[model samples]
Target chain A: MALALDGVSVEVTGATLVRELSLTVESGEVLGLVGPNGSGKSTALRCVYRALRPTTGAVLLDGTDLTALSLRDSARSVAAVAQDNHTELDFTVAEVVALGRFPHHQGGGALSEHDRLLCQEAMRRTDITHLADRGVLSLSGGERQRVLIARALAQQPRVLVLDEPTNHLDVRHQLELLSFVRHCGLTALVALHDLNLAAATCDRLAVLCGGTLVAIGPPADVLTPELVQRVFGVRPTVVTHPHTGVPQLLYTLTGENNP
Target chain B: MTLTKTTADHPPARPTRTGLALPVLALSLTLVVSVVAGVALGPTVVPLPDTLRYLGAALTGGTIGADEVSSYSVIWQVRAPRVLLAAVVGAGLSAIGVAVQAMVRNALADPFILGVSSGASVGASAVVSFGLFAGLGVYALSAAAFLGALAASALVYLVARNRTGVAPLRLVLVGVALAHGFQALMSVIVFFAPFGEAARSVLFWLLGSLGSATWGALPIAGAAVVVAVVVLVRSSWSLDVLAMGDETAASLGVDAEALRRTLFLLTAVVTGALVAVSGAVGFVGLVIPHLVRILAGAGHRGVLTIAPLAGAIFLVWVDLAARSLFAPRELPLGVITALIGVPVFVTLLRRRAYLFGGR
Candidate 1:
């Protein structure tokens, strides 16, 4: 699926949160969106997910207008793992995962065996199968993140949108999730704060500053020292990892004006 | 030998569905036990044998003679209606709680938290104290209450909403303001009440009671609650995802506005019917959902299904305690709920953070 935001901009209370920003993601490709807090990365994702309507322009899935699609139809196409996803009600792991199939099941029939099987598979892919019966409220931060990912996977959506999905996750789950998402071969757009993770996981990178897309390209080309210093205000040494061949950033915070 | 649970958790790879039969069996057991036990209780203290005989005759195609008639009349005409009314109110209150909580995403929100109960109370009091609906007879007060509840909720919703529309925060704020406003109106009315005791009667209507549970009221309340329960259970899946919050629900294709509106109306109807009959039954909606969430997890499929059963049982026991606590004198049912709800809520809050999704 091709996900595109065309001249999308949003304003709330007369303050523009997202400027006229446009970006595109090809099917089965991983696009990483990197920006500082409140730089409108989440807002941009919200447009695609329909949490907020763009003040101007539009979001489209394939060639169809997102605003024109019914909420249920859009949901069948997109799955999101957002920042700070907390449950006010405590749901068991299996029950939470089962909610992912909400768009597919019509009422008045038993949940087919296929539905259960898909839920199980998503959980397994996210490595949350063992926590099936455990209550979500009792789980640790990292484990809960995995369960949420499992939920999005259960939706079995063609386009996956993640907003800092690894916020509270351990390093291991972080790598595992990003890597798994890569191999799953879906159209994925992820907002990540960590530059190395962005470089390691995404096929293409889009950098945002003050609600505008400043750079777009491969991770190695887009995450250069000059770009990092300008966007992130940090001077870093860049090197290639011998095994994975992904670019790594080594930052020196000793500068007087360090970021 | 037993195996240890995994320390590093994974998402559940297998979904173990809760079968309808198990929950249904549990509900059946609760229904039978509660009904039988509730019927056996009351201030009149009819002998067990007499109670059984009355029940037996009522169930089977049999009749009782004049010698045992008073006991039969009290049991059938009086005590039976009250017990059944309590059941209906309990089921209805809890079901409404499930709906409101899901719609608003606030555990503190119950059906009456939106000012509908206060509105109904004002309506009933105007009829009773001012003799507005006097000619309408016994059903008049209840009819006024039902309409008042609906009108108040509609008014509050409209008053709070804007071009951007109804957010949970806006709804709660509006409800609180309107509830206090209604209370103030009641207070003003009570100040200049023509008769002294008339005020007391009207105030009692506000404190919440099922004392007026009549045989006629039972069927109406039953039908209303049954309708609400069926609609809720049918949409249980959507309600479950909704509690997970908006971003997730939207990603999964839930039209948040539509679901919220439908649930808001359903809860209002259920709340209107319930308060019209029983006054403002509080805490059942607030407390039962939290209790069910702890036991059944956060799924509305489970929460809505189990809440009504647990609430019915809880209210029956509480009502029993209310009657028996003072023995010869009957205690207000609202007094018992506050006495119980406050202590239990305090205990839960002491160990835990916030209840009702901790928002």
Candidate 2:
């Protein structure tokens, strides 16, 4: 259940999207990948899900090189909730979620009773059971995102990779989703732009800047003002949350007086 | 609002297999009725009972009265082959349409979208205008057309493919460009032909007809269609995954490139075989799959199963109308299909809240 990216680099058309990015998420741990725009958080996550192969290094599942395993085997262990995952055809929510069980039955076999139960369970957990018969095209963005998350949950993968999964979620759903991930007992690597939520949710934060890992540690140790100012080009007032004692950032506009 | 509902209180119901039974049974019965009507109601005015008797005699190898010989020949030898060919080609085109649409991830895509039919047109025109491949005797046109289709498919695959693999957009663009090029080539061949009759025949072939359907030709087209349908039905899940996009397909352990490659080859060959027998029959391939998807869901298994039956029924009637609507002067099958298909397609677009994948 341990997921490791060992010195992974991705170069596309003469541009290096990610460079020597090494990180590891221990079993059942929630690791947050945070960075400014274009810092390669999405690209790094793509490598873990095998959407894009690393140009140099490898992604390992418990010390086994991912590329060495068959794609079905690798997919059986790692499921992804990728950004921009859109479909033109109108599939009902249940049918879309059932696609998560694809690796378990690769030969276009009919879904077993167990597989159907898993799909139903996934939809229930994501609060999308009511939308099971509705077309995905008809859902609101947040609902669609939850449907996708439900699909990943239906995959029953040991390690989950999510890229910007909270893009369209409301505040309550965002908190609920994060809390679910934290307590779900699955090793997860999440890419997030919301630093506060990342701090509140993740056990460890890995910050990337310019396609390289700039910092990696617990939220309190990694979210220092110097690191935030240097990497994100922001002036931050770091404060401890009164309830959870996690580091939270209150940013001020540049060239403005602080109250 | 329903977020707090517990799984224990409301257990999800399993999907019932019988959901598709009624529609499938309805379509199958409709197809059978259409075939009978296709043979009975042609220009010769054969009575329904007589037509049924002829069909029964032919099927069971029973003896017919001597006085009914000519009518029996008209029903069994002429009308039957053409009607069956219409059904087979219709099924094949519909099956390939589903594959092609999923292959390119475009709702507008059809079996001929990859230029295979245009390529077949070029070869068929050459055979008609210049008697090319005459050594193959009766099979010259089909052989030439199949070769041309294969050649065009190879050209498209090679040009569109790169180290990263074939992207759907690139495949479509390359296919459309090559299709136009092949059309131009066919026109050139038609222009240079010495006889006007050759030009007329090529024109008829281009618009499509089941006029030449024979027992000899039926098995080939039927076999090709059967193989293609089986293969496509088996790959139904893969097709659904592939239609979502290559990246999604890859993440789910389906290799998009390999699947596309196999589909391109399969569709090309089957399309070539179909066009070789029936000419470039239009509309059936483009419209039937969407029609099926609207009635059924977008799942490939359901779409594939129903599309073929619907298409067979549609074409059986269309072909009958082509030969009978104008009486002695038979019309091209494509002309009738377009006349019917365009209006229906436009109405579907206008009336339904359907999005071809999305808005």
For DockQ, the strongest prediction is: 1
Per-model DockQ against the true two-chain complex: 0.42, 0.41
**CAPRI-style quality class for the chain A–B interface of candidate 1:** acceptable
Worst 10 residues of 2 chain B by lDDT: B8-17
Candidate 1 lDDT over A1-259, as tens digits, reads 4999999999988888889898889999999999778888999999988777899999989988888987778888888887757667767788888888887877524467998999999998888888887767767777888888888888888899999877877898788878887888889999999999989999999999989989999988998999998998877889998899989998875745555
Off by over 4 Å in 1: A233-237, A241-243, A254-259, B1-20, B47-62, B321-328, B338-359
TM-score of chain A of each: 0.94, 0.97
lDDT of 2 by residue, A70-111 (tens): 778888999888887778887778888999999999598999
* Top candidate when judged by lDDT against the true structure: 2
TM-score of 1: 0.89
Output DockQ, candidate 2: 0.41
